[model samples]
Target chain A: MEAFLKYFDLLELSQEAGIEDVRKNYDYLKNLYSGDSIEIAALNTDFSPELRQEYLARLDDAHEKLTQLLENKKPAVAQNTVRMDDELCDWIANIACFSGAALKSIRERMVVDLKDMFTTTRIQLQYLEDIENEVFESFRAEVYLRSYLVEYTRFLSLDTPRVLADYLPRYRAWAASRTTPAGMPHL
Target chain B: MIWAIGGGKGGTGKSFITSSMGTYLAQKGRKTILLDADLGGANLHTFFGLTRPRYSLTDFFDKKVALQDISVQSGIANLDLITGSIGSLDSESINHGQKQKLFRHIRALDADHIIIDLGAGTHINTLDTFLLADRMIVVTAPEVTALENMYHFIKSAYFRKLKFIFKAYDLTTSIQETWKNRATYDIHNLKDLIIHLKQSSDRVRDIFDREMSGFVVHIVLNQVRTPRDILVGENLKSVCMNFLGLPVVYAGYARFDEAVLKNINSKEPFMLSNRLSPVATEIKALAENIIAGTHISVRKDVANGSLS
Candidate 1:
């Protein structure tokens, strides 16, 4: 832990800082030392070129090490999630009907695990699986399902209003098909 | 709190910032005193639209005038000014005993805050007054000349502080001897000198580390014209920490505004006339940051040149 903290110190961040914080500070420090700004030029008398190179090298090492450390510490399922390509993003945007299977397929194509979704959204794991499977009976009421869907879509950085507009109707259709209306379950 | 504003170069807005901050503090209901300690060229009174005062620091030093007696009201409520003598008692002439006495009297003044506007250059008198402040602030522009002088000033102040520590311990000769043969000791910079001294004895190491930790200098970037210019403060802080091993607080920055020059030329208190201007807002933020012992946090996007 002490050794790990030294990396945070190098980036001028606290140990509890998030991965975003680490990346931001890393980019900042890297840009600062790599360039020949007046600030660096003014210190030429004290900081030689060789010394600056060493400092930059140390910064790179610290950034690389911290990224790996933070990556490993993330919930197992999120470790493999890659940046969304434009094509994938376009496809997700063109998703006219957000069915449970479609949402599951989108998650799969993005390499996002259900457990990671659960970890981030903090929705019950069983309920998340149920929602992905379109198990309408599993949800006690429409409100719970709608709220969970909102959280899940937001976590995935999708357009919440559009996703809700497409997906909630299907759940309502399922509720109407049942003999009894989907009302709040008794506590 | 006593805040001393000095950068090693002239015409970088030191007096402007000093007078502006003093005005802001006084307007905020703090009993603030503005002491123009730029003895060689004291014109902070001009920033407040005031003519030359009847008394100045010359009265305090040449004759035995109390600092309070010499402090003339700045026409603005809750703010007072102590103008430095023009062409009298150049910084070089003020001996160590006089400097000590001035510092003692400054600390004894009854006010919420005393902001001192120091003259340019790395003169020992200027540095000692800067070091005397609870908050030592260095102001600089984006230009290379201003930056170079700022670095020189900060380095001189750091060395002075180190020498003071050694002198307190009666080890001035030891430090002088080591510095005299710096090549042999591999003391290429302040940090290197510190390392060499720390290896000498545990007592010296403790005193050095303790003093270094307490010796923090705040940086204020003036006349910032672009987002890129804002990053200069953070850049200075980074270099000071990494190379000089000095703790620097990037207090904040004031953007370049033509209105500022207009205000100064007209001898109007810029803060009073342009209270809602961007520069005034920045100065207020900087003053608050200084008082809170916090600094402006440069966003990473700004550092990466992503935010214009």
Candidate 2:
């Protein structure tokens, strides 16, 4: 599933499509290649039946994937974002900064443990530091950032997509402060 | 190999699967012939876009035509179809002896593969023909009603098989009466029947053990929509195995495609017209599996493609 996420672009599906949208797209593409499919007749005059079957199978395979995206399918409402409460965010910071417990003593230690638990999950030290510091600026690509936060928070045993949902608005507000009211591009 | 396609439920696409499978086998260079076993409601020829032929099973019966004479060419190379009787009460009301004679002739067909599409309903004619086939497939759509009807179909086929097995016993008549008389002792389903057989004489139990060990049934799920629907065949196989002790093959599934309707209305063969569709791919895979006799998940010997 993690590897197949790369196919979102290939399937013409947004990284953010809900389960229902995903299902609808799958059906639409499936019908487009069916025996009496008008789409094929109209679009590809020299369409190879073998190629059509292969593409349809790949589309089915892509749609068959659930991954963690389906978990985040429902875009969280403002009140629905996971609440960290000042204390947990402070604790995430404090654990990386000053916790006396051996396992939670450092962000690197926590990351190592999380990496071991989720063997396939890829994480960089910079991303780990940004997550711990609550500095959401560097990871402005909303989709990847939301996905990363969802995983990191889940590893820390947080409320999962809900917490990431809560953090998104804050990130947007912080990003807004750096730009002018005219919405000009700025670092 | 004679493969009988029957599911007690109506509108489960048995004819569609039969026609597609027949076409696929023929395309694979196998000598394949399809029979319309649905006496009263026969329509397998329509899937091949064949509404009428010069000769049909009716002509064989009424005109005293030879069975070979009625084996009409189905257009596809190596494939012939004996068109079904169109609403003939004579075929429907065939006596047991006449039905047996017809089945014997069907079995003698000079083809490598014979796929007979039986009509909906668990009538004795349907069950007997289904049970007589070298291979049997039960088709069901992924709906609660279809699944329920499939269960009933399996049970009926199983009971018919048991009836055949028990006929060998000298005390067959008494055994059947006693087995069915639940008032004397509660025997609930196929499992109970097996348990009842166990308490009988060693010879009766041994005969049953031998015959049933050879019986295998295959299942195909059709018009599946959701991912969960794909598992219905396996789930049905599991239930039958656990409850009835029958070996069921989960051949594969056909995704629901609207083109099925369009093809039907246009009178185009599905696999030929929609060569690249998922339904076509699945049907082809199903044909391969049936040919390989891997439908039995266990290590049972392939029945040599003869259920008899």
Candidate 3:
């Protein structure tokens, strides 16, 4: 739990607050403090100007952080016991190296280089992990993962859907295989 | 939440906005019910492609059917519609007792939202129904007459709310006299009346304060063709805030898409028709803003007046 999760409590919401909740609370708070109407002024007559400004800024920060959380949230995807085909896995492993861009001898140096590039593009470290670890299951839906991959590829100058077109089939096959008795035949 | 959609003028796209908004909210998984409270002109049924509803509110009134029993599937997911029909007993001319009965039945509805598509003009029934809604959206177009009607509707509602609140106290006589004096003097705005009331007893002032605080009016502009049309909503919000002395939220606008006209003709909802269309996108955005309760052009003030 980060320190900012308390902002949810400040807005009288749980940690799992929906987008609607964030919006409603933010709207209400904004109206309550925006200081432009006579009715609300009649209602809250005690708060000084400085106090109102401070409170409004805090609320804006809280609302902004919560919205960012909603945007960056990784959906709860099923991961345990899901396995991928080795042929698809090997292909993904090759793409994971970004067509030899990450194929450098110094592994730590690659992480540092990639981090700077990701920072420039505002892509997350977890997204990079999701792409590199082919054997691991995605903690988000396929659509979101594919879109993130588009941005990820764009950040690395792969800037095309080739990775998505290749990776999604195997991802679907892996997802489908998990539902089978002996984890059905390979794609 | 109960929503009443009405405009002072006719052909300002009340029914179209109602059905589209209902469809949009329903598509978002709300258990939405659209009631054609437009008794005299019960045309909400036509917008959904139905010539007439199999079970209109007539069944509820004449046959004594339950309100729930009269609700029919609107074919939109999670949406049920109660059709209004032109019968011997008119919606516009519903008596006080009948209005009370309908109000009770509407309150008893178990859905997440009851969207009442009110008839045009500010009749007693229309005003009462519009006032009772938890959320009210006044639909208007970009024309002068439409905007004037919207203002008239808000003014009527403002007085209606005062009447309803003052009814509880024995202040009806004084309130009536004050209202009569205002009418005689042509002092139509509530500011002078509110100031006059504050100088009276504390109870009337307290009731006025509480009622004014709770009475939030929302606006949505329909049939917008250009950016100028879209700007009508914000402009209206300013006028209402400054003139009407009531809080107003400009809940965005829907464009005048030709597809929307075709959809109305074909009985296809805008949500299901070309969701990628600009109008559909605006409707969706409208739904988002409504549910989110954001994009309020007028900010609420917390300043206490001399009385408080």
Candidate 4:
């Protein structure tokens, strides 16, 4: 852990920083020292070229090590959840049709949470829940429902066009069932 | 708080910034004292349109007069001026004892802020006085010569500080000897020297890590003409941190305005006359940054050749 933290100290970042922060700071510091601007020119006598090269090498090493460390540490839960099983894939492939309940079953088998999906996709939590529960009335229009489904399927790493092909027909059938036949639905 | 403003090269607006910032602080109701510590070639009094005060640092040194007595009213509210004695005392003439005494009395002076305007060049006296400040500020212009000298000044100050630490540790001779034969140890810069010393023992490393944490210098870029020029401050900060392992705060920058020179010539207090001006706003922001122990955030847009 001490060795791991030294990289963060070199980049002047905290241990809690994400990979993006590490990359940004590394790029900034690298660009800064690599330049031959007047600031560096002034140090010509003292900060020899060899010394600067050595410093740059250290920066490269730190950046590489920090990137690897953070990448390995970042998605421990996500990594475990993303391991696809052959049985699950076969089950998904053999399904006769796609439905909200099928999508919910796949997500639960992978231990993916609705809140995590909302956080990553930035789709509203209520809308995501509505999509999973097949609350078709909550959607304002067919286009909204289609776009939301596409986004939701993409978030789950599902085949988007195929899922849409299977899901849209079901939604259309439900819509047709809800419509009245020639003013017979006044009740 | 005590603020020392110095840049190695002259004519980079060190005194101008000192006077303007002092005036600004005083106008903001802080009892400020402006010390013209440029022992040779002092002219900060002229910025305020004051005639050479009868008693200067000369009295304080030769006559043993108190610093409070040497201070004369700056013709502005809540501001006092201690004019430097021209040609009477150069950096060389002031002994170590005298420098220590001056530093002691400077700290003892009662004021909300004592802004010391130091002379150009990395004189030991100047460096020591600059190190004495609660806030150490370096002012520089955008030109190459100014930037180069600014780096020299900061490097000298950092070395002087390291020497001070080494002296406290009773390893002064060790540093001098190592620096004398630095090539043998493959020490190229101060950072390398520090690393080499740390390898000598754990005690030196601990002392260095503890003592060096407080040695932060604030940079103020003056006379910036273009949008590109403002990025110099950020660049300087980066170089200092990366190359010297020194933490530098880019306090802020002031744009180049001919009116600044005109104000100095006319002896008009620029801060008061141009309080609403952009330069004044920049100076005020920098002063507040220094007071608040904060720095400005500069973003570089390489594609646009501009900064925001």
Mind giving the per-residue lDDT tens digits that candidate 3 earns over B223-267? 877554555566555445544567788887877777877888887
Model 4 stretches astray by more than 4 angstroms: A1-12, A58-187, B173-186, B302-308
RMSD values, in order shown: 13.7, 19.9, 18.2, 15.4
User: What TM-score number comes out for model 2?
Assistant: 0.58
The per-candidate count of clashes, in order, stands at 0, 6, 7, 0
Best by lDDT: 1
Measured by DockQ, the strongest candidate is 1
lDDT of 4 by residue, B1-308 (tens): 99999989999999999999999999999999999999998989999998778789989989999999899988899999999988888888989899889988999999999999999999889998999988999999888788788888988999899878888899998788999999999887777888899888777878887888778999999988777678888877767876776889999999988899899889988998897889999999999999987988766644244333
lDDT of 1 at B107: 96
Off by over 4 Å in 3: A1-187, B87-89, B176-188, B199-201, B296-308
| Candidate 4 residue-wise lDDT at B211 | 88
* C-alpha-based local distance difference test score of model 2: 0.69
Worst 10-residue lDDT window, candidate 1 chain A: A72-81
If you superpose only chain B onto the true chain B, what TM-score does each candidate give?
Answer: 0.94, 0.90, 0.89, 0.93
All candidates' TM-scores?
A: 0.73, 0.58, 0.58, 0.73
Local lDDT at A159 for model 2: 52
Error of 3 at B187 (Å): 6.7
